[model samples]
Target: MILASLLRPLRSFRCVLLFSILIRIGLIIYSEWHDSRSVVKYTDIDYRVFSDAAHFLLNPGPENENVAQGPLKSLLGWKISLGNPYTRETYRYTPLLALLVSPNDWSHPSFGKYLFALCDIVNGILIYKLLVNVILPSSSHNAASQPPNKTEKHASGPQHKRDELSRTEIEALATTFSAIHLLNPMVFSISTRGSSESVLSLFVLMTLYASLTKRWDAAAIMLGVSTHWKIYPVVYGVACVSALSGGSVGSTSWHLSLVNQKTIRFALLSAFTFGILNVVCFLIWGHPFLEETYLYHLHRLDHRHNFSPYFYFTYLTYPPLVKQPLDSESLSSWNQLMRSPLTSFVPQMTLALGAGLYYGHRIDDLPFAWFVQTVVFVNFNKVCTSQYFLWYLLLLPLILPRFHVSRRQAFTYVGVWIALQAFWLGEAYRLEFLGEDVFLSLWMRGLVYVLGNCWVLVELMKAYS
Candidate 1:
């Protein structure tokens, strides 16, 4: 009776949250069973990488001794034999994963699946809070034009409307976030599939929540940690600094004083926190650590299972090359350009810089602008993994509610995006699993992905502009 009374406040969502948890638990059990039986484990590649690193850290050998020295040693013409700790293998994740999993019996296959599921739950709850608090309130201004009852009449001014979400609004917002994060099949598939994207998404949500609450130092610190987990969150650091500056949201007027002492203080703290962790990693594992964790990502361009828009370029130039193994040393100079570090680096930088500057200037609405900037950053990323979709998916509840779109328009927009994803995945399935040499179709799918992203961006502009 007491539990029922307490859950009555959450109303329908109490059941929803419980059901979501059950669904995730079921998925985890199924995945564990599948892993035990299947000869070719699907998500085993990434899980093995993390678990191997953890085991290595827990039990080092003579092979781990030849840690590479600084690049300056090579520049100074010193004979430095960089040990291939992971000669045919690579652990591209940060040491934080190794640290977290090493002590917790990560040797077991179920540990990662369980950890990811827990993080997925955390993400759902965080998204719910963000919606009920930050986003719904910012959107209430449009509703403010309507007549408020006696209760709302006594309500505080526009800035503080966030403090007063009605029961119905709260229920609706809770339902939306819970349904999106908890009930979405994509979330289930990713978590059960043993992707660490769930953990990354949780940190991203926490960082967003802190920024929304104007906890500058807290937001900065979280962003730094999240970036350490995965390099992509570094892009959101710009949004963090912008939010801390505390200018009016959605405004074009730029403030020279925006770059003030408080901003600098927070920025420095964030940098120090971020730099210290990476430095410690270097000290512990030496140059090989940095190379695998950081450099490997920049250099990775797999034509085999690549779903990036750049794949189209590779297809057009060398259709046959898609089937070849990833022997970087054997590639010709022109073929190397197809997977060149410069190719992805320059464009990603340009887009991120432009988006950061544009949205950073307009601070009429920090949360919304942050969402736009984040989506823009991901849209422009060189390597768009399917799982990376969660980075923006978790934020959509906040943005979509605020967007003044018609029901039909919203449905159409979502349908188009899903269709694009489905088309790409279908092609990928044919090639990767069925052994179909549908290289040309894969190129078409990449083009469709690009177009779909462009459409989404256009709609975002319409909503904000």
Candidate 2:
């Protein structure tokens, strides 16, 4: 029975992977011709930095003991610039990313796209596996990603078995999820653009999948790697620790629960992995690794081309009153503190923690909780961008069937969300390119978009029981 069950999924995965690969290859080839003919290229400029960083690491001028396989020079502080790290020439992300892309051949510049494209495909497979392993055994089939209840797990009657998804139903759900992810235009193009968002999605889902299977050590490793790659996934730490405790939050005080042995085990392992990575890289790259990767993102201030509702407000407080560490001293004056862009982070974190606690308190709730958490995090962040949406987009497929909304309602909500973004894009185009004074108008649109997002969230909550 086990062998048959396993083979069925393997066959299903192979079919979907082949189809996804063909579609991506076609789009990538078309992009090569299409990009060259247009004013704007389909390949993002960020791709240049990723590819170049790889080649730079392959050979860094003989600084470390003349080691021939000398990627040790990759750690030199002077090799990459942290000042104005925003440019395509300078690498602003993790050293691990450089190593990941180091094997790509510069002879074929699109190699990074191909590499990220594979990550996108593998993410789809992980989504399928996640659905199959996690199940609310007694709930309706629509609730695809949740652990079986204790009663359901112990039950031996035919009714208990009947509640479980059959091979056919599970296969159907897997197909739908894989198709949703691989075929989504935004998700597809993210890889083609060569943004590492797909890679991030891979690690994030791997962590979630590992946790769902109760693979604590593996989950901790993946969570650590994901967090190190980009700091945002650290927020999911709350959800993970809570889920691992198995609704133990009620039996123990909050502090005690946080200090629970399970929590400590996961935390220490994850932190150790994170620390070892930084320490090894810091030895070579020096302080810039810490400053550029972590610090810069914490207080990042970019008002232009921003979609956050705080965009106009941040613009008003553009040049910060003072450049200082994020300490109580910097927040001494109410006037300065209230006006700072970082003030928006208060609500961003509050909503994220609230969502994480309410929804991520149990294994059954983790999948949807993660989706909600990511959406809330991205929506209210001081710096919001389209690419950030992919954080949730990867998990969006898992909980899609759990919602009870009609097709019409789903279309209405999605259409409104897309329409609001389109409206903002039009206003931004006029302000940036047409050089119109549309700041106030853009702010108004942004406010309405924020309200629209709220409405969608409320409707989703109501429909997802």
Candidate 3:
């Protein structure tokens, strides 16, 4: 009864949403104040790009406006030139993003920031729903099938009823889900800085929620729209389709049939929706939309701020005319496994597809499936940035409660993760800011960071699955 009393108020989502709003208001004020005092503003550059694109679209000017420029060339033998398609880092997403934030130009400057914060809160609310509708139900089903405990065998009334979670406990867990997403440092900072990831995250969860509830069309359309908005979520369509085609946990198995009606329908509808969006964008933005938004990302090569395991290779293979902070004669002795750019694509796709098929085979594990798939995709990606981490972080909390890791084990993994990151950042700082030749050292640290990530992934699999 004491525990129940403590949890009762937490179940009130209305109160939770109110608290989130108040916190966002405070964050907005704090961010604006901080930016006013700083040399560089706290607002993300993407926000500026979005505003510029909107201004250009709303009222055409006689001059040419260059948004982003990609002059990167291939590292080794392949002369993969991105050829100054964009002049600077401008709006590189769908024109609809500019449309969403265009109101900021005429209205308040922080209009888009407010929109993203609201979406962040909505992402929290969706996680709460996912916990209630999908995760908790599976836990309860598993509990019911197991043998009863001493409390269940000896007690009367509610205690003996399947030994399931009470309404109060479920509500508390849902509120916990909200807390994890809304209050997380990484997630909170990204949304407050005016990135559209919060918006993208909302659609990802919406697609999952819609699919688990057996709303096929809603799921398909949601998936399509999110993919159009940002390309990463398209990988999740595989997991959703896998979950739909498979059966319950114990009886889950793979089979092939021409008339597996549900998956076929889902696939066709999603493709149609995506194709329609592409056609519409093509008419509006011409070939530039296809080139800049989609193809640019595919052939993206970040040689300067590179973070992948292939970073050193990317750096070493730069054209001889390009100046390096330090000559890497020692580094030249190491063999290059990849002679060309885009070599990582095969391994990335293979692992991602394998994870989708394996975890999505069990409907009960769909959240885990998406989380693992995103982690693999981001880790192996050719160009990884700070924001890309949010892709998997959005799905992490849904499966966290089930992880069997003890506090000590969890802390150890977290400490190693943070330590490795600090080491990489420190080494990178020495090379970039101090004009030191720490490139080789930074590359070695980058390899260690990738190893650290793999360790965490293995631990997560053992703890949760």
All models, RMSD in angstroms: 6.6, 7.1, 7.6
TM-score, predicted candidate 1 vs. hidden true structure: 0.80
Q: Candidate 2, clashing residue pairs?
A: 75-284, 75-285, 135-146
What is the lDDT ranking, best to worst?
2, 3, 1
Clash count (model 3, backbone only):
6
**lDDT, candidate 2, residue 193?**
78
Worst 10 residues of 3 by lDDT: 67-76
For model 3, the superposed segments whose C-alpha errors exceed 4 Å read: 1-15, 62-89, 147-162, 247-259, 319-341
Candidate 3: C-alpha RMSD to true structure equals: 7.6
Give the alpha carbon lDDT tens digit for every residue of 290-332 in model 2: 7767877776667675778877876766666555654546554
TM-score of each: 0.80, 0.82, 0.83
lDDT of 3 by residue, 1-465 (tens): 999887566567777677677888787778889888998888888877777676665654332343211112112233321122223255578767777877887887788889999999888888888887777766766755667665444332221347577777776776776677776878777777888898888888888888777788999998998999988778877777778776543442454521278888988888898888887666455566787789877655457655688777767765432233233453343323332334877777788877886678666677889899998888887777668888988987788756655567778888987787897899899998999988888989888888888889988898663
| lDDT value for model 1 | 0.67
Compared with the true structure, the alpha-carbon lDDT of candidate 2 equals: 0.73
Compared with the true structure, what per-residue lDDT tens digits does model 1 show for residues 1-465? 999786554456667678778888888787767778998664647776766666655554463354344443445654444332343266777767765666434356568778888888887778777766666665565555455444443332232243456758665766655677787898878877777888888888787778778787887888888887787777766755665566654556545545878779877887887898888667555677687888877756555555576766655455435456546566676777776677876777666655665565433355555566666666556567776777777776656555555556667888888898888888889998899988878867877787787887778667552
Which is the winner by lDDT between candidate 1 and candidate 3? 3
What 10-residue stretch in candidate 1 is worst by lDDT? Answer: 153-162
